[model samples]
Target: MARLREEAERVQAALGAAEVQLERLGQARETVTEVLAEPDAATTGQARPR
Candidate 1:
């Protein structure tokens, strides 16, 4: 019973983290859309640590 409870808590925590990440991704999409609306600096990629 105790183990089951612990597992449930862990699952709940992971789910919460996933939700937060999803929200951040949504916000990032909105930001990109706004940035791209200018048609000047419309681009995206990646950069490694300096």
Candidate 2:
């Protein structure tokens, strides 16, 4: 019973970490989507200086 409890705790900790990673990935996807939705600099005739 103690071993089972320890396994459960480990699984819970891993799940928490996974959730945080997922949230960060979701935010990154949102940022990329927003950037892609914007007009392209080339098309707008406003080239970005490198």
Give the candidate number with the greatest lDDT. Answer: 2
Candidate 2: list runs displaced more than 4 Å.
Answer: 47-50
Instruction: Give the alpha carbon lDDT tens digit for every residue of 1-50 in model 2.
Output: 99999999999999999999999999999989988997899899987565
The 10-residue segment with the lowest total lDDT in model 2: 41-50
Model 1 stretches with alpha carbons more than 4 Å out: 39-50
Give the count of colliding residue pairs in each prediction: 0, 0
> What does candidate 1's lDDT look like per residue over 1-50, in tens digits?
99999999999999999999999999999988976675443243444234
Residue 42 C-alpha lDDT in model 1: 27
Error of 2 at 26 (Å): 0.8
Deviation of model 2 at 23, angstroms: 0.5
lDDT of 1 at 30: 99
Error of 1 at 31 (Å): 0.1
